[model samples]
Target: MLCYEELREAVDNGYIIGDTLNVVRKNGKVFDYALPGEPVRPWEIVTVESLIDIMTELSNYQ
Candidate 1:
């Protein structure tokens, strides 16, 4: 799935909160958008699916 799509889904489902996103593109680029002073952090995932994805990424680096 696309990174933005996954982020959107997580937000819509209330799986993430209090943080913003910095999506890494397929071309190995990091894209982060934030307000001047809001300084939002990474989103919080309150779902199992998000946790699974995170674990998958971690294992890949191992």
Candidate 2:
């Protein structure tokens, strides 16, 4: 699982939204992007490391 810090950065950068109730797969893999202001699931796992990679890719936007 990725760290929270990296996930937060991704959320802040608009790379991912952490508001889904239960977007992950049954085995705790794969995540669905949530809309803004949506309620987040209590057991949702934030992937900071994954977010870092996503954000890094998005940073190339001009």
Query: What tens-digit string does per-residue lDDT give for candidate 1 at 1-62?
Result: 24445545665787555444333333332233232244454552222233344434534543
Q: Give the Cα error of residue 31 in candidate 2, in Å.
A: 10
Those runs of model 1 whose alpha carbons end farther than 4 Å from true positions after fitting are 20-62
Clashes of 2: 2
**TM-scores of all models?**
0.29, 0.30
Colliding pairs, model 2? 6-48, 7-48
Best by lDDT: 2
What's the lDDT for all of these models? 0.40, 0.46
Q: Candidate 2 residues 1-62, lDDT tens each?
A: 33345455666787764433223332554344344466668776544334444444334431
- RMSD in Å for candidate 2, one decimal? 9.5
